[model samples]
Target: MMRRLCWLVMILAWSTWGAAAVEREAQRPAALSVYQDLGGTLNVEQVAALPEAVFRELPERRFFHEYSHSAFWLRLQMSAEQREAHRHWLSVGDPRLSDIQVYVPDGNGWQRMQAGAAHPPESWPVVARQPLFRLQATEQVVLIRVVGDSLLVVEPLLRSDGELLAQRRAIAVADGLTLGIVLLVVPLSLVIGFIMRSSLLAAHAAAVLSYILLVCVVNGYLVHWPMLVPWTSYIRAFASLVGFVCFLGYLRVLLQVARLPSLWARLYDGVLAAYLASALWVVFVDHVQGRFLTEWVMRLAAYGLLPLTLLTAWRRGLPLVWMAWAVPLLYLLQFLARYVFQADHLPWQARQESYSISSTLPGVALLTCTLMTELYRSRARQRWAQQERSQRRLEARGRLEAAVARRTEQLRTSLDARGALLARLGQELRGPLLDIIGSARRLVAMSSSDYPQRIERNARSQLELIEDLAALSHRDELPGPSLRAGSLHAFWREMVEEAELLAARQNNRFQWRLGGNVPCEVMADFGHLRRILLNLLGNAAKFTREGSITLGLDCLERDGQRVRLRFSVEDTGIGIHPDDRVRLGQPFVRGRNVEWIDGFGLGLDIVRQLLEGMNSVLHLADDDRPGSRFSFEVCLMLAGVQDVASVEAGA
Candidate 1:
């Protein structure tokens, strides 16, 4: 009886102690003050049950050397004694965490709520820009694990419903402002680029877009786009490369880097290519090696860019370009101090402020200002050129008017001699006609004797070839392309045979091919088509020396009864520039790249006129290589079987 009574007393004493411990936990603050581990590979149970004595022993050092593989763990506590449950939330400092796992208190075990950079925003417990988790103050213990691919840092804070709302409102305002700025600048930059045809402006705009996207990623807003979040690492890695490429391209144009000596320009191009290759590596391969290669390339590029370009442009009086160096300076500084040296020993709040979106602001602003200055300068130059052109036009008009008045006066004075002039002109014309008849009679007399038959044959061929030249010279008065039923392939074959003959005369190699199984017959103008091909081939041969000329014909598109025939003439000669292509079809306007080649530039003009007559259009592609290519497409009605006989006769 005495032993039983002792056991009952021991049980009653243990129950009383347990009740007192529960009461102390209930009295704790509603907000979680501090967490336990900063960096480790610990799981939720390991963290939650960690002895109080163990946490008190370690000093807080947020920066660890093995940050890439380490995980950050935080312990949160709340009283389960509340009269009514209230909404609470957890906030993480860094936005680029690769993984986030939250452990909430359950009946017997912990309940896990998961999120990460790779996860969609909607899947998160609380869908905010950064990782946010909904909570109730009734939970006993909550734990969070943060993982990152690179250096990982953790900053956790518990907030009430009111605090979260206020924070969200502030974030909304900042986001709106940022998006508004981006929206306004993108279109404006595009418009300026279009108006001035400045590649620098276009590149600047692309850089801005890349900058915004990078910001979205580093700030965790990219989670909103579920499809894109999966490529978070690639996107983050590519952002720096894209920005650098665009910025460098802008500088290349604005600073006239291409004006450097050929050897130096080639070196510069090679460096850019290396950087691009590294960037591509990062996108398609391992980010770790890619990041290293890209960083080294950027560092080496800095040597060429900083003193050579930034300082050089400043010396040449570009203030905006000079001011733009701040970005690189800050980036280098941040890299050297925080990333390279592993100097991120400060608390989470300070580190977040040091290397986030706020750091890129000044550089972004400087770039914008520089682009704006360039835009204004472009407009000013355009206006000045316009004024100068107008002044020259007026002067030319005045000179032309004076010349016309003087000529009119001369004509009026010469009216008295006009009758004699006409009589002399008619006499001269009659003499030429009589001479032609006399020469023919003499040639006939000689033909019966010893005149060379070759001379007569050559003379007849020259007359026939001159007939087409005569028709081309009178293109304005001549009729359009005469459409008729003909075997398109046979006609093209004949033209190719003729082109081979022409190319042979010029000692140029000629190649012609028909694409696929082309329709045997097409409703085409044999006469005009022959003229077009002959002109194109003749020009190709004239320009090409010890080189090749290629003629290609293919049916590009087909409808019910009509097919679009695509034709191309590519020649191993000096290629055309994009700028010169605009005036290519104008009579007597040769491409600047044509150099010393002898051409009145009438060949392409005639071809364009003929194609237009056939209701076709001409298209200039990138269209340039070690040589040049001129291409056109024409829609023609397909010929039926009955047209074959007529086609044979026409050919």
Candidate 2:
């Protein structure tokens, strides 16, 4: 009976203490109803003077108004005992709010404390990423006003100092990590874009940069960097606009709109234009309306247009296009969940500012992977193309070698036949030609008739033609010039006589001109030189009828042991047609105008070949005197020691 009484006494004491504790907890301040200043014109004094029935209560502690033009007012009612028991703080969870003012009752009037993006962090009652204010011990009624252009989520929290400090620290850590990620991803995207020279990568980099800027502005990091604080509003607006534009541009490039069907391509272009126009509106027009337009446009692109475009590109053989859009789509969903739907109850909803900023990483990583894969595929294609080209070239070379071998064998056989035919012709024709020439000479000696001389000259010309044909056939086998010391004066006199005789055949007059500085003696192959001049003079003489032919020699330059001489043969006859000049040096090719009077057209070609062997080129100079002139320059060693020594001394 004594033990039972003791237990009952203990249980009774515990029950009384628990009941009192429950009553005390129920009395503690729990919920504070929020109110809106719909007109946004109410001052702290007016709001304080208004009755409690004037303001409408919020459904919860949180409110979201995208681009709110009016201010929101929150009235927290607390007893002096409750305020003293808990050293409370009024924390506005949004950092992007443009203006925040807290009114704490101070004796007879209100002591106002300010914190928001509008006021720099230095002036804040508690310096943190979000607006925080400490409530006074005696304050019973606190008025909080919030205003901004950004999407407003006013989550006013009444917490103790330790809870506020812990929240601030968590926010700081999240923001720091976000900043670190942005810093890492942005430059990396830029570098990869630049290195790869990829339009897709470049567009992605621009999107990342612009989106990060928007994230920084929205997260209220501008206050940390004071230089950016003044242009906070402008930065936020422009960053949002540019971010949307960049994302659309990235999608366009990734989809390769040019390769899409015409209708889809045009639709993509139209949407892109709309985005660009919205960005312009944000800059030059009202930002609030412009941002509203931009948001809708972004939603259309991100949710509707981009997916369709990706689908179109995928069907058209771009299999990886969907993979590229996956991360961005995920980011978009996250954005919708957090800002649009206000689903703060989700697991990932904590530290949403950090989540929004750091979400760019997955997209960047996806882009990097896509670019690397593309690079690898490109290298593979290049290697395959190189191998294919090499294989084709090898096959072509083998065919060419076989063709060349067959052609060489045929040429060898044909050359043997040509040699036999030439030998037979030489044996058969030379005897008759010799007989005809001997008879003509005898007839010429027997009678003073011009016909015998004509016959003899014709026979000699025929013999010369035959010799030119033989030379043309064996040109490649010909030896170099056999240089010998010779007198240039004597050689010139002999050439002049021959030229005059040849010219007289066509009733043409021949003239010779020698420069004053023509060398007296030179070391040259007179045989080849004589043949060259004979061919040119013969051509001139043969083409001209009752016209004049002139052969000129000039000393172009005189060095110590070498004399460069210019030789020219000019004819005042039917000049060579421009169209026929190009064919003049080809074997069996003659000027079109001179076709009626020519033998086999082997003279000029033979002249060209001989000049080539002697390191000279034949040039046809344009003459304004109704004639064509063929000129060539040749360098010969001065044979006379006295002449060379004189030239050296003069030099």
lDDT of 2 by residue, 350-442 (tens): 443342554555555565566566567668878999999999999999999999999999998888778667656765677788889999999
lDDT per residue (tens digit) for residues 4-116 in model 1: 53454355345434433432332223444333354555677777777754543113323222224356665555556431445366665566677888888787788888787
Q: What is the TM-score of each candidate against the true structure?
A: 0.49, 0.53
Among these predictions, the greatest TM-score belongs to: 2
Candidate topping lDDT: 2
User: Relative to the true structure, how large is the alpha-carbon lDDT of every model?
Assistant: 0.65, 0.73
Clashing pairs in 1: none
TM-score of 1: 0.49
